[model samples]
Target: AQSVTQPDIHITVSEGASLELRCNYSYGATPYLFWYVQSPGQGLQLLLKYFSGDTLVQGIKGFEAEFKRSQSSFNLRKPSVHWSDAAEYFCAVGVREGFKTIFGAGTRLFVKA
Candidate 1:
């Protein structure tokens, strides 16, 4: 079985500050990884993904992630965040079906100026 755990249920950060979110995964083999962002009452959008290759991958919205095989982790990072960046973030493991995906519970982010 494959699963993801986000230790922080919620986080709050000030505008123009650096941000980092923790993600841990449990899988029998190397699995596809992704990070998605969802605004309040909205659907999720893919931030980034790691399949096979470079450990570090970049994505939209000025975000990046590194796949660490040793730690079994893929953490998301943003050097400086904007107020609009405030939203719910989810780290997910890709499971193969015909064509589908599953997501974590999510971590709500609040931005205070």
Candidate 2:
């Protein structure tokens, strides 16, 4: 069974502070990992993905993640977060099948001025 766990149910960051979101997973073999962000009423947007090759993966909207196989973790980071970055973020794992994807509960980001 594959699963994704986001330790923090929610995270709060200052408008210009650096941010990091944690994600851990349990999978049998090499798993396809991804990070998605959902703004207020919008659908999920692909923030980044790690399908192998490099441990460090970069995505849209000034986001990047590093995959640590030994730790079974893929954490997202941003050097400086903007207020517009506040939203729900989900970490997920999928097989080559593409249909069997498991997503974490999600971490809602709140940016404070």
lDDT of each: 0.90, 0.95
User: Which tens-of-lDDT digit does each residue in 1-113 have in candidate 2?
Assistant: 78899999999999999999999999989989999999889899999999989899989999999999999999999999999999999999996565788999999999999
Every candidate's CA RMSD: 1.3, 1.1
Per model, state how many residue pairs clash: 0, 0
Clashing pairs in 2: none
Looking at model 1, residue 56 earns an lDDT score of 95
Structural similarity to truth (TM-score) of each candidate: 0.93, 0.95
Model 1 residue 92 lDDT? 94
Scored by lDDT, the top model is 2
For residue 1, what is the lDDT in candidate 1? Answer: 63
Candidate 2 Cα RMSD (Å):
1.1
